[model samples]
Target chain A: MLYTPHLTTRKIMPEMQEFPMLSLSSRITPEHLFYIRNHFPYPIIDMRTWGLQINGLVNRPLYLRYHDLLQMHQVSIPVTLECAGEKRALFVPKTRGEQWELGASSHAVWTGVRLMDILKAACILPNAMEVTFEGMDKGVRTDMQGIFTYMRSLPIKEALNPDLLIALYMNGKPLPFRHGYPARLIVPGWYGMASVKWLQRITIIDQPFKGPFQAVDYVYVNTAKPVETIRLNSTIAQPSDQQVLAKGEHLLLGTAISGDSPVLFVEVSFDNGMTWQPASWLDPHESYSWRRWCLKWTATNSGTYDISVRATDAAGNVQPEIADWNEKGYGYNAIQKIRVYVD
Target chain B: MLYTPHLTTRKIMPEMQEFPMLSLSSRITPEHLFYIRNHFPYPIIDMRTWGLQINGLVNRPLYLRYHDLLQMHQVSIPVTLECAGEKRALFVPKTRGEQWELGASSHAVWTGVRLMDILKAACILPNAMEVTFEGMDKGVRTDMQGIFTYMRSLPIKEALNPDLLIALYMNGKPLPFRHGYPARLIVPGWYGMASVKWLQRITIIDQPFKGPFQAVDYVYVNTAKPVETIRLNSTIAQPSDQQVLAKGEHLLLGTAISGDSPVLFVEVSFDNGMTWQPASWLDPHESYSWRRWCLKWTATNSGTYDISVRATDAAGNVQPEIADWNEKGYGYNAIQKIRVYVD
Candidate 1:
């Protein structure tokens, strides 16, 4: 089915577009408005001939048609997928890559068969250490020679997690071409990069995967470790930076999310953090989805005010005042500061 | 002479306004456009009754009229005065303060009597260790009870610096009321906080002065030291962040400044600092004023580009990729990053 894209384009060649956060009022984002992060143009696919191949270090090397996965038991869940370099432009040194602001993130309910069920049927070998997923998209990287396909790997234990799914549908509809048509791997609670789209092959390997996307691009250059869980973060949707408003009551809006835990609270500061007041949660707490929040603010004085917001997760992760800098500019989750004027 | 204020008001109570940097073309800012950093409302003064009292540790107590200062030899020099809180909003942890961006700075040629000459006339005693300058503006601070006047002190050595001036004229005209009317202290090479405005008293002390502006404010909270010299910095004036443009040659404009030393070079990075190219200097180097620089860039691809700028001083101080985080958010001279799009 064809649909009009609702994302704001940041890049044209590879077609990278981000969701408009100001338009978000619901926990589940519309499928069309879901942010699109692509490394290459959508790979042409003939759904009639498509098949999923599960091989390497397994008892049964199975090649099953797309219809076979639909026949298996399915699970549905709402998950937030945020780009690893979501706020790359805000980094101090400005790392090289897509200069995404705070929009390269979105949430949606996905429905598909659990990967654990499929992996059990394949009968993984005892020596297997990782599961590598490969997509059909190919591209030339300036850092490396020759054309290469997008690929990534996850630990054996993580691959078998109950929440991991080979998603076939998004928001109760067949996945669109831009988001991977026949099937895609959905690794919840992790960055979008870990969930390989346009997925065609899965290999259970005996050792770690060394593909550039897995070992180089997605890894924090300063620490040489792959970025995993999402950091505790909050974004202000109202009274944007340098916005002028009338001196009276105003509603402040934002969203907070974490990867492994639910948000405990979100705080808003009007006096440059001298004091913080709790913001009311607008949405029910969900383990894998962002919670919308709002605060009623009254500005009696006419002047410029510095407004800041911070969030804390149930796992004791408080949004930092300053995130650690990385060369790739991944995972910047510092408290948000927006300066506005009351006139 | 009445002139229209060309500044952008940041605060209206204490009358704080900032220069519109995009309107800057010359090294010296117009008197009406120079940024104003005030702690309190402008104090009313009668020229017939106004006198500068120089006493305390001096062997001779002297009160000089405004004309008395004009009788002394006058020295003129261009100086750049930057607020300590400039760029406070850019701090990662989100500092508490005015939330000033890059506009809280300006350059001007000041004509006045040398502060050293005035001190010589006052005859400093051997016990003098520090010299304090006090302003007439008074206000009540939330951090401290009761009323307090804006005051700051300089070391005896720095007080004797030949470059320091009792400025009476700014940009070839009598100092405007918004800027310090009759006479003001100009602490060259130091942050603007040290330059007491509406000068009414000067005291030489045997030890350090512990006024709030000296002991508490105008300090790096993390270091507990008074912020002094300005940091090497640069600001982009053209093709602002998130600005969209046609895919063609465009001129990138900006200014670089330093306190004690001249800016040696300014570099622009197109590939997230992987490589940097030198920008052509447009203004001649001045000891205490910002120099304008520009680069002609051609965007061949239709995509977002992360353009960054960094300035290096002759003193070997290079702008940092990440400035050290401070509670008061002083001295943030990190390299600037502006994302622009070509379509």
Candidate 2:
């Protein structure tokens, strides 16, 4: 038999220090772990040349260098960072791409100044319906041709939440090179993709930013329908990636969140998508981030078993058994099914 | 002025190596990063004396040594382990407790022998309604006088899930001392409290295990009520414990799950509980585990602000703005509000 540690006693060495935590525990420490995601290579910004241009739908166009931004009202807030597709690697059914085993999310304490403060300095415009942010990352998708720059936009109303900011430090320290240093945007409760790194410009426009990063990519579509529709989805993040288990009774634990509404409950199935049982909630702190839940199950037979999990939000949204597959594989929140073995 | 990183570039580290995706990117390797949650010191068992006794309401009492369990049908399953209060520390109300900043959860490839196989060997009695598990950890709570052994119980139907097991190893290795070693219960889709570490005995009973661990200790009650009522709640895991942020447009992201039903949606409020907005779902995967979601907000003012998040499940279960407070802090899914600042 392949010997493996039980769930309560597994020991794994971490690759990096400063594992992020909401509080602290013996099992998880600050130095041993935490996941990191970067959209652009760390930009080597010359503080002298780093200037933020706020124009477009605004009444005033202002150019604020790094020094100018520093001179503005400085603020710090505790916020969380989540990848748009943190669990996408696990949702790829039969397809091999960036196979992330559910470890793409994290939290941190950000310290910086608010974007609204800078925008206010430039006077608000009347027709501003959306706010667009441009980053310094320069890359192109294999299927696309242009040297695509990473950019994201949000409704102007969302741009006014008091938690948003332009960060320069993390965890009470200078931003690391791997993490966007010098400057970055912090969208307190949105996906990490919306929080553009190496931020350079903020444009207030009457319409949403129709950039490659926004309209072309990161959008989910129905696999059975046309590619124009965008739907919502969620993912699980607790069970390790590619985990092998000797099943009897096991707790299914992870997190879930939604776009249209607040997550209500999480469901689990052990009988190859046959029966699903509601998992218990550990904490449903917010609708914007993942909620933690757990299900208890016992392994009765010995065979390769398929286990699947899905979620529903308060808005009556249930995770589809199969997400509409889009060409870019944007929103793949289909029922996440895993194959395990009983002795 | 404080400078925080952009929410887009900020990354949330997964709780464990098994979980590798975030709102934006995936962790590069499993070894360097991963989350871990340990309940007690790992125990070493002598196979000769370390026998599992199945008694109580069973038709036949059976005492099987560790070796005997190995001889029985062995099982393995991939599961996730999470602390009930992994993100409690981030609550802005400043509850009196060990503030966990997140990372009190983890996923692992667990290998173990099936519990049902042994239960069948003992011949379960017809009147059995619950199964109780006993572990080696013993402690005394301020409310209780005598030294109490750690134990928990599950309904007979839940104990019969085909994925549950008696985990012996984790991540393809012997159980670590910090985690439950020798043997432990792997109750899939439940909180870590249910998966008793250092397991020593299994008892079948017609009554629920009303021990301190179940009734008084690991339970939650509405503080406003008589503290006897049980209330449900949820948590977000992505932004991660005390994440400092800069003021501007940002995304608040995390995962949530529930025990009674599937998570429906997550909501966020930046103005100290003045208004609420729904977060976007990144993946609608398993409801038993975690669901990923995010909220987009732009900081308009610069000051210490309270950000709150709440969740609702498919069954119309909304995380209460205030949960009943129990003596033992369980079910703390009240609207988790965080205090952040913009410059």
Candidate 3:
């Protein structure tokens, strides 16, 4: 197993861990450091017997072995996956969940065959309106009856996106045991919940999937609407909150990302939102990946300052001043506020 | 004026500001860097006409010049003053006020004559029940009908504490304009609110004083009882929240303080409160002033950690796991929890 002692473990039963935002200084997160989110304990998978099953609404029912998929055309791309509940602890009134602060998201290179490529081989029928992906992991839920597998669905239009991948490799290395050893799904531009791990079967359906994860858990409690695409967000990586520094030049660094489009630009405010200045981009704009930005701040005087950062995506979505708070605490994309003292 | 550009500004009219927690590493905070909490605009004072008035229930009402009090027995001691509303923003229900995070407190050397010494010379009448301190600054209150000066009171028994002073100097220098010029009352061991500034009068009352500041604002909203002594509290000064450090031997530092007694010991927890280890004291035990503490933390593995610190006072009061929730958010003495990442 790769060295992964750095991830912060939020739960031990289902094995949920988070990536540290300070590690965002690196363009692509190391596979071992990438966050892991699971619904149930790791399912015992025998590589020799593991197979990918594709059926329902398809002319050809295909069940291919792991070696058979490895022989298919493989594509590698960098993508960012953010948990819907990232920054859930920041919500007022206290939401229920893992209470992740701001590290429930990470970026990495995923390599695998495009799910569309597999669907084309299966010859999807015209009547397929949505496709459901189910993981082998199953457990009993207090809110539901009997045992249920971790399952989620995507609309046919989203499912057909060529960017969606049946990922087999992370950061150019075989998937680690804790991060779905055999295989996992990678739905770019969407929350991590859509990328089901411990992949087992895919079925095309004529209607939306209403499993507990898709219907009750991940949905915004106030609206009862399922969360999907990642929201525009930015977080400071330098001058950690309440840090003190000597009066001098300091680099204010942070990262920004959006699922819909590349971050167009980032702006920072030092006077509590009174004035904003453009920050220099550290990394070239890349779709489906976090963009690092920084500003050279020279402190001529000593004082405590509430530094804030906001990002605007190419699609014109700017991080809001105050996020629309929901009971489940999904999609918290408010401007990042960090307080620092310079002496 | 000593150069003080480091204080964080919370309001402008009355000039409320906070000293950064990172600057707490030093035992004695500089006069200019000390937090400034004011209710009304600074009241202009002419040193020539300024005189402390001792009247009401006193047997011999007396008006003494500043120089006259200076000639009396004078003493200097280091004391820490914390605003009752410090960490008010951490309240879950969200209280209504300045919304100070944690910088609204600091330590300074105060030099002045004891309030008990003045009360003795003035011959307080046996019927005196309380002492009312009134500041020169005045403003119209939305809750009240007419203009009102900032005022508060202390029971006669507590008012006689020899440590309480009508301070004239801070950090070995005459009080600065913003701190309170000429003279100000310093009720050691009490919240900063009771240490009335811009002192203009001291009236010994025959009954409990019911000024707005005493009976309305500083009191807990749910209980309606006034907040008095500072709560036992501790704060991490190093490895600030979300800070990323290289994996190695590092020193964890922090400061703890209490109003009732000196901090007896401090403990650090790295395993999320499961087990705690003692932290070495960096400063000699000093009552009414913060005690600095540090621990050697060697990180053998890279991982995200929720480092927590808790302090126990000599009076046998230990910091609580969770502070009692109050509407106004006063006396937040919960154990300090800070998250950091090691890579």
The model with the greatest TM-score is: 3
Lowest-sum lDDT 10-residue window in model 3 chain B: B1-10
Q: Candidate 2: DockQ?
A: 0.02
What's the true lDDT of residue A240 in model 2?
Answer: 29
**Alpha-carbon RMSD, each predicted model:** 15.9, 20.6, 17.3
User: What shift in Å separates residue B84 of candidate 3 from its native position after superposition?
Assistant: 20
Query: Comparing only chain A of model 3 with the true chain A, what is the TM-score?
Result: 0.96
Tens-digit lDDT track for model 3 on A1-343? 1111255545544666677665465878877667777777678788788998999999998997888888999999898888998887777655556667677888888899899999999999999999999898888663445888999999999999999999888889887766665778999989999998878899999988889899987888777777998889998877666554557799998889888877899999988889999999888877788888999999878777889999998778889898879966798889988877665
lDDT of 2 by residue, B164-256 (tens): 888877777776544566777888777777887778899998876789767765555444321211233444443332233345687676656
Q: How close is candidate 1 to the true structure, as a TM-score?
A: 0.54
State in Å the error of residue A232, model 2. 5.7
Ranking by TM-score: 3, 1, 2
Q: Over the stretch A1-343, how does candidate 2's per-residue lDDT look in tens digits? A: 0111111111111111122322222221121133445443445567767787888877789887877776777787655455554444334342222323344455566778887777787788878898988887766453445676678888888788766888877777776544566678888656667877778888899865778667755665443422221234544443322233444576666656564566777788768667878888876455344556777777666555666788887778788876555433445567776554444
The runs of at least 3 residues in candidate 3 whose Cα sits more than 4 Å from the true structure, single-residue gaps closed, are A1-5, B1-343
Worst lDDT run of 10 residues, candidate 2 chain B, spans B1-10
**lDDT of every predicted structure (CA atoms):** 0.83, 0.59, 0.81
Judging by lDDT against the true structure, name the best candidate: 1
TM-score of each: 0.54, 0.44, 0.55
Query: Quick one: ranking by lDDT, best first?
Result: 1, 3, 2
